[model samples]
Target: MERSNNTAVTYDSDMQSADLDHLELDSAQKKIGLLRLILCSAIGIFVFFVSVPHNGDTEIVFSIIYNKLVGLMGNFAYWVLVLIIAANFVCHLYYKYIKKGSCQSAFAKVYDNDSVLHTLLYALGLVYVVLYAMKVNIPGFEGPEIIVGAATGESVMPSIVLGVLGIIIVGALFMPFLLNYGILEIIGALLEPLMRPLFKVPGKAALDAVASFVSSSSLGVLITNRLWRKNVYTEKEMVSIMTGFSAVSIGFAYLVINTAGLGHQFVKVYGISFVLVFIMEMIMVRIWPIKKKKNVFYNGHEQTEAERREDTKMSLSLIPKGCTRAVKRAYIAKGVPSEVIASLKDSFLILPQVLTMLSAIGVSGLILANYTPIFKWIGYIFQPLLILFRVPDVAAIAPSLPVGIAEMFLPVLLISGNIGAISVKARAFVTIVSMVQIIFFSETATVMLATKSPIKFREIVICFLERTIIAIPLAAAVIHLFF
Candidate 1:
């Protein structure tokens, strides 16, 4: 009996020891897994954000690939893009507006206004199809010619198409890595304190702003919408980022500079615009209309767990924890192919809206600038302001200021040769202002109106006016200081 009791005790001790060893091994394995995720994620974030030379110019990897694809495909690529956009417009109009097709009943009921708007866009697309693709000229339609030429022309349309393509590729191939792998979470944690206090937005917004700067403003808005949908941002926060921080892409800035005859002074032009736009953003976020927006997150989840981390503390483990979270996210996220398709779907949904609305608004804005005295009357409001800055040719320059609403590029185009009349300082002033205007019907405005964000069309116009009112003087001050 004594020997039996002793044997039982020994068995229990061995079992407990084995269990503890197994637990330790499992814990070590998890740590190893987390470290691996952190390393892989860090590599991905670096590649996407870092710019390198591709064909003798520096840009991000995605831009290099997009430019190559554009070079390889050439005009055929634009034709394909335009056709795809037109087809989507027609289908959306027919299924959602004309027939109210039950196949898409769920989507239709939710986006009735979108369907109605798309129907009108379909008509505009048809006009452009006739004008650009078919080369058919209609009498009394001279107003649309410039827009047609601009949209389908060698430079503008190609750039727009390439931008979308880059989004499709990058969003598909890389976005999943960043979003799923906790790269955004890590960056958000690091930047959250700065972003939230200063911008009243989550640190995740830093990604949107960077994406927009590197890719396109349209891409930035798309990202903002995604963040909003995912419960990461409130409607107000998304709108603020979309409108304020989502400036034109670096590529577009380069185009703007080259077009404005400031290519030789590219560094100065871009640097000044960048500084003034940020300054304007700081002021705009605290002002009315924007400040009035309700700061409510999607699904009412205001404080995410990651966000609750005491931002004041810094630890080496934060990065690994971020990566571990990213790994879990990436695992939950759909595969690369699905993500790419989703990206393409987003592009399709937005392109028709951009093409249609840009056509109508751009044409009208151009017409008003060219044929009427409307802008001239509006120009008077800025005349005194421009004169205050000592910008020469105030009459000619003031009219161009209001035309930026039609398209940011219009102001530059309107003032093209006439810029010689103004001092180089004033030329710098106008160049920076046009880029900072932020409200242009051609791309950004169209996308804003198409979005489900609560910002109304009137508010967008008001914001544009507000941006101009603030940007002009600030730009003038910077130009005078530098030039």
Candidate 2:
């Protein structure tokens, strides 16, 4: 989720006798809070019992386990089934601790109020329950086509696994900010000067680059957001900096790409494309040259009342101190209430745009499904572009188009379709494209949120179009010339 411009506020209707605004939990909850640690340890033990083959791909193990089970207990679904069991256990403990003792965290306070994490966990677990309950017949998942391969642990185990994974992921994502204030202070000091000359923008720091490359994009955006709020940057500079890092989260770049179905080539193309995009925007900033009419312009004339209150709470005393304070500040600024608002907005606002994108791609895919015609089309598209780089038509479409989304399983798809056996060139194309991004949709929310620029359909389309114009052909050449 994007960081909110507004400060994080946890409304506390459950105030105590002393009536401190910060509504801490009682002594019992604090003492029993150790249960979360216990649950995590339990999950760790369960993971060991399962003997999960954490081979880069668990398909063989998962599929074989799927074949052996006669009932849900012995079934592959049981692992995920455990998620629901574990979640319930954890939730009970969470509630018990809060009621019994002091709840220290504002995150814990807000978790009590908004129930955002609970909703996601419940929604995810319920998906498994509903799917298995319907238990009709399909080959692998035992569901209808619409719900095909719908990540059935169709058991609670998947849910539990996700819950654990969620804990890991949230910690990883949240930690840098929790721990990196010293780095930021150092970065803001050291990198600001060098940043200007390298990017030709007045001042967005190396911190932006470090954050984008090493951690989450939301964090990099947060840093930029802070600078903007403090009036350290002009309006156009904000746009340039935001665009320079339109992609977010090293998680997708590293974990999902390298560790998942897509392999090394995917990583290379995506890394290169993003690097190019960053470079191009930096170059483009020099070309467009932000003409500032005023000394500065923000989304408004002044920081709003909400912003003022949150800032005061953060700097003065609303936040608790420790290894977690900066994260709490940033997170609270983009807290539960605001997350609810943004998620709702994205669900509604992004629908039509998603439908439009899907529709256009669907039509094109139908025509391009024929290999003979598709190759001809690719030749026509890339021949002229290839001339600019002194290369022949690479005939490799993977790097050139937004195929990441379509061909995530291109290796499997090609193996099934007999495409791999037919031609070396086609195999190369599939490999390269699969290695790159999975189009922008799977990543739509992140991509849209990464930018401070207005993330409307038209603007996104325009930015994507700019990349498509060059990215694909460059990829084709790389594939042809190298692998």
Candidate 3:
């Protein structure tokens, strides 16, 4: 309802620290990263030789990833063993030499309690493998453990390795698209032209287009917010622009949804989201046409240039690495007592959080797989829903919304397998919905925080309904034409 709009990836891990500047010491997150690296890397390798194809129809491309991890980890069996030492090395460096609130933000935040590495690694979803491998099941989310049990078949190593491959391959495939390119090209060109026509906002199209590429929606939103404040866009423009722009959060739509059995819907979900946004923006432009008022022109949604500048300056100052830290440290370092810095260990919590996430994902995957029949049955009832989207009756499988309850990346997993199960038409339906923005809690939070806007819980619900309404037909078309 407020000014809506959209950037590139900042680490999902770094999000927890948005409000933690008050804390002095860097985080104490360890072990969890190590375990994550091991389980996922190993599982990734397993995916290569076993479930994946030999390039025939290429149902899944397994070995392509397993070999890569073997190279990165040196040995699949101890991927975490190596990753741990590496993570500790970085943490120790931060603990020793780095002085927060005293130096450049990009370089300084590295040592600050919330290191950028945490964000990147956490985004990878490896932590899920470790917790499940250790049989740690989150009380409410028992699904992941069950998935691990099923994935590894009798051996956790096989399942863990397959999972490992899944996480890494997914991470690598779109890393650049997820991160910023500074010169946005392919995707940028594709989505940018719509800005002036749809939202009437203007600036770098590619920069904001990162939202479409990766799972971490927050990163893209932050970038857009910064641009908006720079006066790159008008307030109404920002809102209207994002009408089509704020499809699904890439993280949830890609990483989480696909992980559940509905992984195949990636293209379908994303395609629908894109088409809907484009349509909405065009409609808004036609209806309002950016009309001018008799006196000082304004829409209920517009932010004054001065207000825009002020917000932009504050956000830029806060987000960047150098000045913000200098200012914060100047105040804290002067008289806060050096002893407080020494006791800062209590504040860092990435290791535990990672552990929680990893356990939840693994258990959730296991449970879902164990109850595959239940899902199939659910698919039968949902066949009507698929029918609405023009999904073929023979190609039905319930959408993969369950993995979110336990693991974040489970959505990606679901897309990989079941999408191929249905007719190409059904597959297309699944792919588009899977990619449409929204659904994932992580994605929802990213949009809310980055824009500093008030998007209600119900707003997301409405967004989903609108997107789904538009997507069903598009998916059907893809199936009818291609498959």
Candidate 4:
């Protein structure tokens, strides 16, 4: 009996061990599956969004696809964007004025302060839709086609749609891989010392700068807002990044250069742009308003610096250290699909706001520039500065300078129209200054205001002036030296 009992016990123990091994195997397979999904998705996003070596001119893979879709869909794609913006208008109107108990909901509270202005803006958006989409002509209020053109144009809407979609695909989908795999942390670790010392910000800020340069500045602010919400960045740091470092992307830089008839001067102009922006960033963060910003994280937590390399022997090898950190991060990252869905939801919520604000400010500002002398009135402030720099056609150039505050591309458009009036050096100066100015209501400023970050309109306006002031002479010097 004892011998029989021992045999049964040993068999049971063996079966239990086999089950444990099988369970581990199953877990390992799941992890591998997830890792593959993340890596493949990341590679696909990078190939599509990031520029690659292509015949002479750089083109993003998705832009080619988007242009084709727009061509195929024709006016349908254009109307679709208009309708989407109109829908946003309707929803905001319902929440602010029509819906039952709308005020009780969190959504309504967001527009409580500016519901009237927003309603008027949305109404104007719908009008512009009619003006541009249907080609409706109204007497006396003869449209400033250039101003409303941006709101209802093929270029801007397609860019906005594709940008949001890119955020969903690249940011939502691939971010886990980038974050989990230790790309960000390792980058943070490598650059922290320099970033913190110069900008008074953490090394992770390098990612924001790169994202802004490669992607859009608005997207950079979105990432900064994300980090701020996650308590990775404090208010001061987030504000510093959003206002100072988030210049237009390389792609947009190319657009401004091409539009301003400075494609020949691309290399020098582009280099001067980003370098001058960085130098001004260091100055901006150390000055007023930005300097007075509260240094507390979103959740009231203090951001502690990453531990020094001396704390761990693995830190001796940068690659191994980064890989180890990435592995740990990837292990804890949220599931891919859920994260992507969350990103999509966030984009949808922000779409109407972006369209409304961008449309309102873009149209009105363009009107002021075209029909009124407000830009000229504002031009006086920049007149002396332009004169000091010896920019040709100072009166013409002065008005163009402040118009960029409305839209970055506006300055380029103005320069392009009057290309014969300004020297090559002045053109180069305008191109770099417009890009580095960075605070345009049509996109960057509007997006920054939408974020929960500590930036205010007053502050943004101040930063715009400061950047323009700082960038001008530096850009002029570069133009004199190189152009």
Best by lDDT: 4
- Between 3 and 4, whose lDDT is larger? 4
Which tens-of-lDDT digit does each residue in 14-67 have in candidate 3? 111112233332222223322333343344234322344544633223334534
Clashing pairs in 4: 180-330, 181-326, 182-326
Model 1 scores a TM of 0.80
* Clash counts for the predictions, in order: 3, 32, 74, 3
Candidate order (lDDT): 4, 1, 3, 2
Residue 446, candidate 4: C-alpha displacement in angstroms: 1.4
Q: Where is the poorest 10-residue window by lDDT in model 3?
A: 1-10
Alpha-carbon RMSD, each predicted model: 8.8, 14.3, 16.1, 8.6
**In model 2, which regions exceed 4 Å deviation?**
1-182, 200-243, 246-277, 284-400, 404-439, 445-453, 473-483
Candidate 1: list runs displaced more than 4 Å.
Answer: 1-47, 98-111, 115-117, 136-144, 150-156, 300-338, 341-351, 358-373
What is the model-wide C-alpha lDDT for candidate 1? Answer: 0.64
lDDT of 4 at 190: 62
Candidate 2 lDDT tens digits, 1-483: 222224543432111111222333334433332232233323322321223444463422212232233233343433343343345435434654445335645323323432443344344334534454345333354654223233212211232222222322232333333222222322233343445545644322554545544444433444454455435444555555654553434433544344333455666645654555554565545533322222243534432334222222213232222212222222222333443354334332322222222222322232233233453444455446645544432343323343333223322343334443334433443343333332243233222332223334454444444544544455556656655
List residue ranges in candidate 3 displaced over 4 A.
1-144, 147-193, 214-222, 225-277, 280-390, 398-421, 437-439, 442-458
Per-residue accuracy of model 1 over 1-483 as CA lDDT, tens digit each: 011211322121112111222222134435543554576466556655678877687887766666676678754654655665566576676667567656655444434566455566656644544454433233354434554554333223445534555555555455555554446666766676677667777667888878777767776777777677666677778788888877887877888787677899998899778777767877888997888886677776454455434453555665664544444343334444665576556555555555555555555555566667887789899988888877666776787788788778777777777756656765667678888877776667766776566688888888899999998778777766777
TM-score of each predicted structure versus truth: 0.80, 0.43, 0.40, 0.80
Displacement of the residue 76 alpha carbon in candidate 1, Å: 3.2
